[model samples]
Target: MASLVKKTKKPALQPLSFHSHPTMPPPPQTTLSTVLHLVLFLLLSSTTTAISTSQDTSDLEQDCTNKWIHIRDLPPQFNLDLLKNCSEYPLFDNFCSYLSNHGLGQKTYNDSHSWYRTDPFMLELIFHRRMLEYPCLTSDPNLANAIYLPYYAGLDSLKYLFGPAVNSSFLHGLDLFHYLAHQDSESIWHKNFGHDHFLVMARPAWDFCQPLSNDPPIFGTSLLELPEFYNVTMLTFEARAFPWQEIAIPYPTSFHPSNLALFEAWINRLRRTRRSTLMLFAAGGGISANPNVRRSIRLECDNSTNVSLNGSITMKYAKLCEFVDCSNGICEHDPIRFMKPMLQASFCLQPPGDTPTRRSTFDGILAGCIPVFFEELSAKKQYKWHLPEEKYEEFSVFIPKEEVVFKGLKILDVLMSIPRAEVRRMREKVLEMIPRVMYRKHGSSLGLRSKKDAFDIAIDGTLQRIKSRLEDSA
Candidate 1:
């Protein structure tokens, strides 16, 4: 056995075989150089891929930036003149004051409040101002992908809407149509019969759609009824259900943040707010034609004049409800008086006002209060461009007006039945939607290119829609 044994000398270093060994010692210099080269190759490849990915992202952002739009230099009567002589409107006592602060109305909140007496119908002025400052605006129409008509159609309709010359409601709209007809044949108007063009309406679609049966002309015009306007896309506060060129936009709220920091601060304040009341109803009882709806809601919240003001709880299950009784219609434009109750309540009542749509729907969102809508058209059917249609329950509750008015189902009982954890989640969702519905102050030098507010969303959607149509036609 001793004679058969053979011994070999151990080398200074053993050769590393990556293929053979699960674990191997460090390689020699030559092999180490190869390994380094492999690593360097991988790193370079990875860097190339990274650069490519960055370039892709940058290209996407550039594409968005390149989605240029042109604003038709409309006559002053269309926009500027309307604002200059806003005094003539006489819709409000100080109608001209609403034109100040970029059409946000006089500052009701001087410093920290950031609120104004914004008229619900003042969106035309607000939108025009925002479009003027749009970053991608091109003066050359040939280079434009979409055209904006800054016509004060809403303001223009006011004179004819409520006036005696109801038959002449289509005068200004016809003037606009004639103005477009006179444009060069090669112009954008003729390119797609104004299909690539869009305008923002400060009123509901019904106000512009005057039917032949509309006797006494109860505040409506034939503007939308114009055949020439069929192709033009309209961004309205309240759009018709279907087959109309109207798209519903968020109603202008009193809280318009000047900058992103201010916006974030407001959001944080809402998140940290201590809600003391179970629910809030801050509108005028006189606003709704169906008196029973408001009466039922008021009675359920123990806010009816007899029960709330007299300090008598007639109901067995009366809850601490906040009411901003704008019985005289004073709180309609004043946000400071109305939003406080919303901030202190878990839910804000958004029953149908003069129309099914109310400015309070968006205001409740701004205050981070979950909205309690009584009508489908109130919030769910509208705001498809801004609100999550599928996730309505995430941020809102729907109680049919028929149930409350006829069946006598209690709103407080329904809202109180939801677990507190669910309420917190809903509130968070509501807070998350504040920015989308809010029309933040435009032309801020604060580099808010990334933060798309209501204006941004509407414009982007409009441009995209036009682009898709143009592409399909091409």
Candidate 2:
């Protein structure tokens, strides 16, 4: 018992206080929760940046792959949504519906109010009337006239066929008004009438302020008192004196060299004026020995103060087909010689002769070249496949006067400045439009598709402009 008590007493004083230790250091202020939060934040930021980079790469690749994005490629639902933004016009809806229902071959009747009517003469008359009273008739009278004559004649025929009792006076009145409205102040009708009355009479069918009146009014005071007439007017470009002063007259008899002269003059002019960037002309025969006009053209070009002609000149006019010389239409059928050169050119200058609208320009457009146009001798005739002004702005070019001196900019230089790839794309777009802008007379598929025509392109452009103008006005 004594030994056990002594062992317990010795254990109490065994450990002494040890304050300063060399082996251990102090702990840091950072907690485990704070360290975990910083790591998670860095991981989320990195993941988000990687995802954004991957999306950007994907978008860039898609844009590079799809070159020609057509309007049709848009989703049907998206297209419908866009239509909702359009004006609610019953005329447009009905027109689109008619187009959809007719498909292209639908029989066009004289009685049909629709644009697809086969009897274009009466429609031509209506168009001419509209032109007289509007600003739309300034540029191409042949086109205006061509559209109206056939349509009006058909309308007159339809009236006679439907009702024998219908008086010819109605037609006479319509015709007379059109003639008087277009007449000059020196003409018989304008000379006798007072100005105010004449204007009033003309007001029903023609634009008052239009500057193109061939004849100015002799009397202004008494013309405004006339009663309004309800007669339906005809649309047609009237035959008249040539508008532009004669710059140069090619030897009309010599087809080849004279044609070449015209082509060279146009090219030189376009070169002088940078407005027109590209030009092409193809003839059906070799250059004539009698290069009278050609010599003149060369002299003018050499003396040209504005443009210094530096580009290489290649004469492709000799390579075209001479269907005009062929008696049996055999040369016309030879597609290889006739169409190939035109296909190569950027524009085909069309001059009127054989068929009304079948100029070299027609052949060129058929071969995928844009038609550079001048008003024809037959002012009122319309080319069935003529591209409108706006479309022509994108696809074609026009020279108004005969003298190339007015145009002093270099078209070739401007075109050359454009990237080759862009020019190639524009050429392709023109080629694609050919089928829709050309017509084939042979019933054979030698040219563009028969269903499509030049007027279609023009009308489509006109309607679009009208709609746009209306929207802008609104």
Candidate 3:
């Protein structure tokens, strides 16, 4: 009976409700608890969604841009106050003005009657000499100091008080003109003998025999002997002559088979001794024209000194891409590749090799790279003649050779901390200056054409120095 009854156990009695029993009013709610749970769930879900959205946006933005694009968008930092807006300076205008003003520029070549009358090259020498004397003309104090004191007063006097002395010194110091004459031995010997006989005869007696022990010859035999005699005589005397002066004027005494090497050695010595000066050696054809020069520059930059040599002043050479080669005819290599990286980098090392002024600095500026300069060695000094100490505060970073290693390390650290976007903007600013700052002597003439010359822009900061110096002296 028990087994038969257990097989049919009644299902648990369904709760009898008259109208679904009011659906068992959900378990009595704790208002606070319920509200808290709902809020927590919502916050968790929202946070997850927000994180996903942020990450997606970041990825998208990153995917759309690169370092170059950002750099290209930045603004330029060079001071343009001095430059005439990408146009060449009016040499003719300056010359005309000088002529009208009865300045040294008015002097004509070889009047034959006037003592001041001389070769055309002498005029250029005089002009350069005069330019170096006036503090106003020379933007930097160092350059002014480099000008010989005697040359300074003579050239700056407006009357060219030392023109005769300059001409005489040039004639005697440089030998190429006489060598080029190729006169008959009689004429050559007689002419030269008459003019230089005192020097020639005095040299052997003074140097070799030491005839006058009290006031021995001030210079060596090499200084007194003619070029033809240099090979013939064994006097072995070192000439104490300004290499540049000799090259500029040309004379028998100045002619040396090793003149080129001597000039290079002199330049090297100047660069080495004057650590404050930034040297720029520019050459065409990607520095292949003179690898030795390039090597020398590299040695100077990398090993000799750590002073703030402009990146453009380095002996290190980089082949620029074709796109940035403004010198369409002169620059044969592709400029874009070189420029692209330079624009990206903070410094563009430019060491001139063969060209008058290192073109690399302009390339660096075009690429938006700040030039690291050795002020004195760069031929650009012949034009701008001063370091833009203030204006360059924003765009360029200068370092003396002694501080290069330390300063370079510091700069790297600073650069790393800067945001990528900001760095790009800075570079872009530099690149933007190409049209305004760079000048192609042949393409756009010389100097700047628009408002001011590149020299003005470059020396804007130095102008402040002039003002300050003037004020201080006042």
| Candidate achieving the largest TM-score | 1
lDDT of 3: 0.28
The ten-residue window of minimal lDDT in model 3 covers 67-76
Off by over 4 Å in 1: 1-61, 91-94, 163-165, 212-218, 286-291, 303-319, 445-448, 471-474
| C-alpha lDDT of residue 359 in model 3 | 44
lDDT of 3 by residue, 118-216 (tens): 112112222222222222322221222111111111112111112222222312322322432353233433332221111111111112221123233
- List residue ranges in candidate 3 displaced over 4 A: 1-169, 172-346, 350-357, 374-387, 405-422, 428-436, 440-451, 455-474
Model 2, residue 273: C-alpha shift (Å): 29
lDDT by residue (1-474, candidate 1, tens digit) is: 000001123111221011122143321112333334433443353334324433335545586464777777666566655554454445533356466555776655333334566787788878876765565665567767888888888877767854445467756488788777785555568878887899988989988888645556556887887888887889998987774688888998877666555566567667777787778888877334554788887676664323332222223224456777877766665555666667778888989867899888888888888999998898788888799699898899999999999998878768767777999999999988887898877555464456778998998788887887777767
Runs off by more than 4 Å, candidate 2: 1-338, 350-358, 373-388, 398-403, 406-419, 440-474
**TM-score for predicted model 3 compared with the true structure:** 0.26
On residues 1-474, what C-alpha lDDT tens digit does candidate 2 reach at each position?
A: 001011122222321111222243321223334334433432353344324433334554454231111011112222122122122343222112111111111112212111121111122222222222221221222122111111222222222223331232133234434444554333422332211111001111111111222233221111112222211111122211321101100100001111222223322322232212234433332133542322223333234334444343223222221112323433232333334344345445443333223334434544455554444331222322243334554554444323332454333344335454554555555555544433212112322222343333433333343334334435
| Candidate 1 least-lDDT 10 residues | 1-10
When 2 and 3 are scored with TM-score, the better candidate is 2
C-alpha RMSD by candidate, in order: 21.8, 33.8, 36.0
Give the TM-score of each candidate.
0.80, 0.30, 0.26
